[model samples]
Target chain A: MDTAQFNEALAHIRRFETMLVEDGALILKFWLHLSKKEQYKRLKKLEKNPHTRRSVSKRDWRHAKLYDQFVKTAEQAIRQTDSGEAPWLLVEATDWRYRDLTVARTVLESLAKHLSLESAQSEITTQSKPLTPTGTLPSTLTILDTVDLSQCLRAQEYSQALETYQGQLHRLAWAAYEQKCSTIIVFEGWDAGGKGGAIRRMTQAMDARLYRVISTAAPTDEERVHHYLWRFWRHIPRAGRVTIYDRSWYGRVLVERVEGFAKEKEWQRAYLEINDFEEQFAKHGNVVIKFWIHVSQDEQLRRFQEREKIPYKKHKITDEDWRNREKWDVADLLVKKMAQLPEQTKN
Target chain B: MDTAQFNEALAHIRRFETMLVEDGALILKFWLHLSKKEQYKRLKKLEKNPHTRRSVSKRDWRHAKLYDQFVKTAEQAIRQTDSGEAPWLLVEATDWRYRDLTVARTVLESLAKHLSLESAQSEITTQSKPLTPTGTLPSTLTILDTVDLSQCLRAQEYSQALETYQGQLHRLAWAAYEQKCSTIIVFEGWDAGGKGGAIRRMTQAMDARLYRVISTAAPTDEERVHHYLWRFWRHIPRAGRVTIYDRSWYGRVLVERVEGFAKEKEWQRAYLEINDFEEQFAKHGNVVIKFWIHVSQDEQLRRFQEREKIPYKKHKITDEDWRNREKWDVADLLVKKMAQLPEQTKN
Candidate 1:
């Protein structure tokens, strides 16, 4: 390589090793020295041996001739790239016993030190609870209380409005396909909220082949073994497609927090983790949309009772739903807290 | 937010969801709709409720007044971002039962389809082995046979040379520290090669605080649970330092291949895996150096015998090392094979 290329290569190499070391790797470098006369004497002996004569190729002879230049270059490399993290050792190879013993002693000492460090690190386990958004909620007060439940559309107006919007959505979906733009939509809301209904209306307008709907439930055996987001990550749509999530990663800070599935630290970290997860899509030019549907406790209760009376809907209302219903106020508090960004809810 | 800010927010949200979907998340989006008159009626009712009266803020009334513009803007957002992967669903909230039932059924059907697809994916298990560089070495012909053992350095010459190199290394290491440069060096050599001796010589020259030596051994339980490189990544040196690896990642292709520790598929992947590991270091401006020490079988055996005669060195001569020595010819073939690039080694 030329001077520039050589320097570039060295920089690249230094970067590679630094990354490894920073990640907790220890590196060792060693070079054994042999003088020109010593090397020539060794090669001549190899040529004299009938068994090894064939091994003394033209390249070996050429390399031998370039020994002085090679030594200079190697020395330059050692000087330029050597760092405190990865030091190079030059061994005088004239004495076999000394060379081997020195290397062995270094290896033993380093191993002992590394192990000691590892043990010390393991002893340090920080048990401090992460600081999260702090605010006490009155049982009757929540953001959901602000939504006017009386809002409704007449049948005639509803059909007309739905038709108009659906048609527009269908055209837009195709446009996105042509542009190769992907979209993701997340729906998180009350158990009995109209989340599913809203999703159906949108999907009905688009081509059936154009979109996919994901309904997140309890973790499966496989999902339980991995991260909470692992199951969700398995269904990401290809470009120019749609993937709708009935529920999302928000559970970590919501239901999981309420139910004690995620510890204080894990859920506290979720805010940043969730943001990071979303940031990836933004970087990739993909579209994301999230919606929260709210329903009053009375409405939820009414829906739960109606479901129990209906055969098809009965299957949807589980004992778990009833159990979760009792904690509605707590869930409401979590919802409000999760909605605010870290800065917005510092206290 | 203003028009441009609103658009930017929408774009950001879209990208976030898109990323989640791409990672296998199924996203669902839903919006509940209410007419202006209905919204006003609901807010008025809430204002009369003693428990919820305090929740009706000025913002709520202001939002009610912006209903028309809000609807228009929501429509704009839906149209601009609607894609195949993540579709939007709008539900008419007039009838509670209708809204709840539609959403529940859509969720049920979508989940069924998603589960079926997941099962189908799991059924596909491709077991094809990766193609690696291929060549055969005759037992009589090996790379180790080429090293001439006759080369030796005089005691005076060795001492002078060692001092010069050590002094340069000490200076270079501190310079590296000042520059915040990092380096990783890997040593792979024959059982009784001067790898240790070479490493000791270099470490002695550098400040004790400047460099670290990592001796790679059998994988720990933690490492076994992760990628093969996990053990090494755990010891990455900080900036302005050195890390030396005795018996580095190359063991995947060298001893692991010969010893049957790694399967064919795993060893096959190591070439790419190792390159990727180094590339990370290079990208981060860290230096990486790998050294291979070669020794004739006669010299190695002579050293092994000498070590057995010495009290401290005797501990180093284990059955594993002796067994390994018996496979010198095979090891030679592997060393040569590994040294060649894929293109050079390809049959």
Candidate 2:
């Protein structure tokens, strides 16, 4: 909000404007803002609500007090940087009705600017769309929801299949490297549902020279200071390389939203922010694959017990898991909401 | 070494062993290995006389040839996966004596032992060793002797100085990107001078973010085929960084040398055997900068004229500038010898 910070933000916006002019790509940013009183009240209500009481932490309450300063800073930053080419749309998150409507309108506007409604209609006419035939696009069974344990291989067979897949990935990686093509794969699912295990297996076959595995954790100090998208931008592979994200930017919507780690406004605006990020990746000629490993609550509990018993793996079991479990119904509702999101809306 | 097939001759050494399990601190690597023919020639020639035919391409002949394959492969790979703990060393290019001596001594000695040298040394000596003044250390000017520039500005005039620097660099660059915490600067210099204008102004007001600039040209195609680094490994910055190079690894030693690109034996060892590559950057953290801007002899003449164009600039142009001009006579003599190196060694 100071003069120097404002100028720096303006310079960044100008650079993006130049890119938009040259590349024919429009840049859109959204701010999800919640007032301090509203945020505190929401947390207080959550703590008092018997069903959701345990999920509200002392730390979260502390953050809620400083929510005013956070919003003020965000407002000034947006005002200073917003321009004709890329303007910031602020979402009022105190009311869900206002929030979702604002998001849908902003998205429709940006999409319209990128691809006019007339053009979209013409494209739709040209493109064949799929029909939901019976179980083809099941409402009850998602790609995550259908991860059957019975279909999994025995230990020996698992190793063999893993080796084969790893080899395939490795050769594919080398081919990509030799051809200077880049690839990005995203893994997301229920915690402890073999996401890391599957990733380790996939990486095993790659030529140490061709691929990298990036694990996303809590935002670092530097990462917290920048836009949420900024940290993800740093990992895009150069020509002829591959990058794998264990958990990805979707945390902004998933854990951050359901767990109250991010403000309602921030997570609410993330759908479009994420879509924009993926759009950029596609434009950059990267082959992107997203996998969501779904595990049932029963399976999650079994793994949680296993982690507690194992000495080395004990560190991975955090108090957060127990807390998240307390609001499984809410998390489930959010995940279902995320699942229903149109493919084009949030890649 | 035929004109049509000149690039293929860059294949020289096959596999490069660049890693070692050394004392705890992973020492970075730069391997400068020379073949027996080249080694014998140097030992025999040096024994007979102090002066041997100095070839321009010969300086990087071996590096360029070996660079193409190994360096590129190595750079593309994440080294930690290959060896669980130890980091690989990037072997740099040099004469046979230097290459062999470094490998046999520093690299091997560091690799074989698990002892922490620093801690052990500290334990042995209660007080740190004081610097004993040698009869005389090499003058600071010799280190900077390669630079050829007319002017420099001080920190007090930073705004004007920054404007000039940014303007000159913007004009010089073909492409630019600002990634999080990394900036890459690339420069291509001549055999000696012509690098001053770019290097002299680059280091001022550098950010804590890792900034690296690589200069490239004239390595064997064999060097070309392997890893991208088969030539530039020694210069990568590990953390928040900045690196500048005098000359980079493009030599499969041909353009000015015989065989049109580089001779058979002289530049033969580089192609598929280079060790430095993309993986290093992909796996590690740093911003990469690569530049190759060289002045022609005529431009050199103009620049020298301009240097002495005013009384204030007269001090900038020196006898060394004239001496380097004279060295090109020696340069041509060396070029002839380089033209014959490949056939002489291989045959």
Candidate 3:
């Protein structure tokens, strides 16, 4: 899409009122129009007036010359978006008074019509629920059930396997650097499921200078200023390097969803947003690896009890961990529903 | 040491002129004094004045009550630091004009004496070298000679050895984390000396989230605003994490020294400063590891040639690399001399 078309589409998508229009909500848009001659005359007047001269620039004249092109694109946008629930009102802006009056009349007329329709609908179905449809997940079964919690590796076998994998990973990491390929590994798991241990196993085989481990925690003041994903984007590895994330953006769907930290609509829309984000990574030819270390509820409890007896490990087991355990089933259900999201989102 | 004695020692050490006092340089020191009653009287006057009210605070009043203690410490500092060349000129600061006049006269007298001495010395030693002594290294031999370049590992042995070490490092890293011990690893080496390779081996065994590799390059505008060491200090890993430096602050003494980027005296004094810096790390129970990869001149040349023939590696072989190779002997001599510094400095 051209710049103008893209900007118009972005504006539409960003406006919550525009989205609501699709659900039969009233939304009236006004397009103020001025002819090329009228725009140039106004520009000249602005330049001549000392009060407005500072606001005028060379770019103003430059864009004025392309007024026809802008009008064509804007007209196309209006036609495409014009609908019964969200109608566009075109007002000729050559005269300020006429433009203002037309815009005011259009808004008042739309509001009156919407109010009348709402009143009639309320009278006809006073006992019925509102007809807003909520989107449903594709699956209800928790993916946690599929994990074989009983699976365990003997200490000796685990050591041997770790050695083999580390050796291979060491070589592969160098090859990746030589080939200018970047890799990102994401670790998300249940409490005390050995995510840190597994991550350590992979990093042990790589060069200290070639990878960075980002342990996600509460967002800093600077991070909170931007979109939630901005912090993650800022740490994306440079070419031929690796970035490993502990926990990750999935908290928006998992913990945030279960804890009601995010609104229902916000978490529901995050699935598509996350998919688009990962799609960009795939497009950039980055290798994305994700792991969910699964462990049984009994094992987690046993570990927590064991941690309480160890001085160094005691801090890792907190009252908050115990509180979170109480909501395991709720989290489990939400996670399973999230698992039904397209696998492509994990990339 | 008490605060007053500490400041006196700090001032003496920080001033190059003070150090040169033994060499017959004329140095003047100043110690401003005010009685407890006089200071409190002035502070009250300042507080009552609108122009100085902004500077007054509860802390100032609290400190005012300690005026007698401060006076005792100041007198002790002045007596301890009294020297023939850099004599302390104590001025009663209760009266501003008297204090200013005393300071000005002291500086003027010292400057006159210094000028006359310099003129006399120049006349007497027209052909003789100055008596200032330069600190010399203990030896002229390059430490590179101590490295056995003939050392090599076969492919199979290298793989097996790498796995064993990686496993050990992995466990140690976790232990360090649990114990809240930070680790710093410094890498320095000749071109094609496999610094990157060795670093990769060590990092591969670590958890990706527990370590960060910092590759030093030219300082950015922000970095240039602070001391050269500030950049390195800013990246020091938090508790339980590892920070690996590809090259480090040693550049102030190494590359900057040989390349004439730093003055002779600057690099000369860096030894003590760096020693103190590393001593702090040791005191904090942080593990510090340093490595210097050694490669024979012939081996480096062969590797450079090999890199030039490989498509991906060719970019690593540049004209700058060739130029640096030409100064190998000079760099080798300087590096060996630096190695003679106390072992604590290396850590």
| Better-scoring candidate (lDDT), 2 or 3 | 3
Error of 3 at B131 (Å): 24
Clashing pairs in 3: A200-B207, A203-B204, A204-B204, A204-B205, A204-B206, A205-B204, A205-B205, A206-B204, A207-B200, A213-B209
- The digit string of per-residue lDDT tens for model 3 on A1-347 reads 77775765545444434435423467778888888888888889978865446457899889999998888878777777776666778889988899889888888888898889888966774332211113244435556677777787999999999899888887778778778888888898888888888888888888787899999987765566556677898888999899999988898888777666665656666676666666667556788887887777788899989989999999888999998887776666667776766678343
lDDT of 3 by residue, B230-298 (tens): 789888989999999998988888778767666565566777666666666765779888888888889
TM-score winner, 1 or 3: 3
The global C-alpha lDDT for each of the candidates, from Candidate 1 onward, is: 0.78, 0.58, 0.76
Predictions' DockQ, in order: 0.02, 0.01, 0.01
Off by over 4 Å in 1: A1-143, A342-347, B1-347
Q: What value does the lDDT take at residue A176 in candidate 1?
A: 77
Give the Cα error of residue A38 in candidate 3, in Å: 61
Q: RMSDs, each prediction?
A: 22.1, 25.8, 34.9
Give a tens-digit lDDT track for model 1, residues A1-347: 69886776676567656645543477788788888999899899989975446457899999999998999899888887799877787888767898898788877887788779877965783543322334354344545567788899999999999999988898788777767888889999999898989999999998887799999888766577666777788888888888999999998888887776776666776776676566556546788888999888899999999999999888888999998887776787788766655432111
Model 2 chain A TM-score equals 0.58
**Candidate 2 DockQ vs. native:** 0.01
Model 1, range B101-171, lDDT digits (tens) per residue?
Answer: 87888778777877787779657834433223333544453444566667889999999999999988887
TM-score of chain A of 1: 0.62
Between prediction 1 and prediction 2, the one with superior lDDT is 1
* Share of reference contacts kept by candidate 3: 0.00
- Summing lDDT over every window of 10 consecutive residues in candidate 2 chain A, give the lowest-scoring window: A128-137
Task: Order candidates by TM-score, high to low.
Answer: 3, 2, 1
